[model samples]
Target chain A: MELKGRAHKFGNDVNTDYIISGRHKFKTLDMNELAKYVMEDLDPDFYSKITSGDFIVAGSNFGCGSSREQAPQAIKCAGIGAVLAKSFARIFYRNAINIGLPVVECDTDAISAGDELAVDLSKGIIKNLTQGREIAVKPLPEVMITILNDGGLPAHFRKHGTFNL
Target chain B: MGKTIAEKILSRHSGTETYANEIAVAGLDFVMGQDGTSPLAIRAFNDMGGEKVFDSSKIAMVIDHSAPSPLEGVSALHKLMREFAADKGIKLYDIGCGVCHQLMPEQGHVVSGDLVIGADSHTCSYGAINVFSTGVGSTDLAAGMISGKLWFKVPETFKFQINGKLGRGVYSKDLILYLIGDVTADGATYMAAEYVGEAIDNLSVEARFTISNMAIEMGAKAGLMRADAKTEAWLKAHSDRVSQPVEADPDAVYAKVKEYDASRIGPQVARPHTVDNVSPIEEVEGTLIQQAMLGTCTNGRLEDLIIAAEIVRGKKISPDVRFIVAPSSRQVYLEAMNRGVIQALVEAGAAVVTPGCGPCVGTHNGVPSDGENVISTANRNFKGRMGNNRAFVYLGSPATVAASALNGKITDPRRYVR
Candidate 1:
């Protein structure tokens, strides 16, 4: 599985409230509606600044607060190709994978905003096209890979008739 | 090898020998969701072709995040949850029943040593009773609802050994804040924080709940404490189920261990935009506050309210401050009311709203205005947490918040604790 995108960089401890503010959650649970405000708290022009298939690169502990699926769902709905960070809050990592959003854990110091990059999931490598460097990432667990291959937990369930893992 | 509580509980539920860094498919003893997350779980459950829940009796849902529905869209979502709960014969805690974290334990949905999961991050609060509970997203919650099982990468345990009696006006909230300050927000990512020693043993179940509730602030998957006499007594009073406690072995391996003397700790607060940006009350003292809230899953119990009431019993809060108090549950509310705690707060100019998570999540009720400063007992102080990104939030204990409300500034509570 290969994903190509531009990188949008953020800092450490990016909480869920920053991913999608709780105010928008009060108005709608619709991911598309929430997507318009995705990362709006952190970057007001985030939605308009990037195209589909762009990546959100960040430092450690990304998505650190709340278990609101809207955080990951909004990112996926906004057509983000993946999220790369040094680490992730456990729930957010699980949520992203459950929703079929690729959350890669690797050192993101080399990636900068607007840098063209390609991720090869199977190969566990990130090709920084703009910088002409390749960074290695740990391969996801087999079960997560299977779920991501099936487009997320729901689709995986639809195909397997139960939680395959 | 010795095992920590997390490893033991996951091993028990998974029917395998599990340890840190290993993935285990564990059966859930209970599952829950709140209004903020249940609507999505219901949708995902339906999407996964779920017709009937794995166990209706073990499933619960609460409408507390935006209790009473602040908008038509949210109300529709509430209705969807209602219909779904009815169709599945699951328990539905409608508006005002309480925050799910409080309700789950108070309503007897969980017990010590159980592997519980909820669709809210604060689900880790149940770890106060020795449960290996953690939060998950809606889809994983749906999966748990459908299959009664979910996978977890059993987290390494971080031990916090705190001893010595807490000083006057120094509550568990302060200690937890102090710990968060030392560790930073992501210090314990993917780890279980096991708190023990004299301090924990001496604290009430409610105080323990406050400590465990904020474990996520340090990126801990679960904040656990061994269930002792106090925990057993509280469980006996609040729940009918028998408790089965798990404890880490003496030789249990830990990722890291830190010790603290609680007596040396003072009233602590987390300043604006981040929970880990903590400071002693002296550092943030005299900062003007526009609002002071005294409730949430973090500190809305009867003891917390009683503490606040005692602080502001006969005095009026600052006219410039809009003081709000929301009990964590109807049971706590009724208990406080019968004990005159609510009357004292109201008499002191505090508006006691419905028992649920309203202002804390910025859903409705008492959102702060732009550029306003608010002090609250609830956990988390991230930007936009209170509905206004421009507003500033300070996190403190109930006593601290009440004391600050009296002065309309961030003030230490020790002066008023007597």
Candidate 2:
């Protein structure tokens, strides 16, 4: 499946507290319910029209502070196809991996705002169609790659049933 | 080869002849989660369509974060966590308890030498007991929940060897804030910090916890202390189990080492917008405060209360400033009350709130109005943390916060050190 849309580019250390301030964490349990506040600071209109294919590209240290998983889950549930960042906060990077939201740790210089890119996990490539160029990201290590392929950790566990490794 | 705490634990846990790389992830003994991340994790569980937890009953769960009057999404999230816990027979928790990390050591989940990963960053609070713990996001929680393990890169080590006795008006909060100024926000990024020294040993468990708790604000992976007699004594009072007493080998290698004389450390505060932006209370002297809060997993211990109580004795809170003290736990509140700390605060016009996260996130009580100013002893003073986005937050120690409450402005804590 190809994801296509304008990019939301950000600089380094874009923490969750910055993305959705802790005070604004809605009590609603629904992921779609969280769409109302995604990137509320940068664009209060962010949640209204985040098409299924739009992607969020961050420079580095994305998703820092507070282990609140709502940040990624909200973004994913809001229909963003993937998160492209230079580096990730240790935890959020793992979180996105565990929950099956595609987070690619590639140099974010390849694309700019309004540039459309598609992350092809199966191909280990991000095609920057907007620039008529493409960049490749080192795929997840074999174990994590399998988990991502299985749609994240839970899905992998469900499919394999259990593990001894 | 030098060994950091993260390396020591991971190498030991990974078995000898390990890679000894600080950038590699290691397996964890137990994973922690709370209501804040539990609900979303449960849905991830459902979405994955799983049955049993990936691991045995080695997981710790709590119902903090959105407790004691939650917003819309939070309340429903709490409901789902309970249902998920029951269905999977996961070690679930019910409400009416307190913060997740507070209950961790209380419930005997965070044992010595254990590597723990919690869904919230303050989970670093567990490090007070010699545990290697750090906070991860909900997705990381889901990952650990599914795999029964966590990946941790070995972290660089920063040794904060502090000496000297804490003077009057000086608390662990102040010393730590002073340390943060030197350490800076990203100073210890991806590093494990060891707060060793005479002063730390002299500090109470709550005080040590306060220091270790804020270690994450400096972008640290975890903060550790040598589990000395103080840790032993504190553990005996709280729990009966103690094992894996680890310390740096005398010849242990360190990436960096810092030494501080706590006696010389005075009241420090972080200016608004950044935790690394620290200065003495004297720098921002006379900056009027509209609110003064003394709590959070950071400095909500009994020692913090006593510090505030001593400052407020015979003095009244500024009429224009709302002084709110929310202890980290009910046990802290009870202890403070028995010790007259609560009376000192209340009689001084300070309002005592419940034992939960509020002003820390600016979602609940003590939220300053737009453009107002406040001082707190909590972690992080990011925008809208204690009120409106426009509201200003300055972070100080409990002493600075309490002393400020008396005069309604940032005052030097050293003046009251008598």
Predicted complexes: DockQ each: 0.85, 0.45
Model 1 chain B: worst 10 consecutive residues (lDDT sum): B234-243
Q: How many Å off is the CA of B47 in candidate 2? A: 3.9
Q: Given candidate 2, what's the lDDT at residue B73?
A: 57
lDDT of each: 0.93, 0.76
TM-score of each: 0.99, 0.89
TM-score of candidate 1 chain B vs. the reference = 0.99
Identify the candidate with maximal lDDT: 1
Q: A19-135, model 1: which lDDT tens digit per residue? A: 999899756767898999999888899999878899999999999999999999999999898999999898999899988889999989989888999998878889999999998
Scanning candidate 1 chain A in windows of ten residues, the lowest lDDT window is A24-33
Docking class of 1: high
Give the best candidate by TM-score: 1
Candidate 1, residue B106: how far the Cα is off, in Å: 0.8
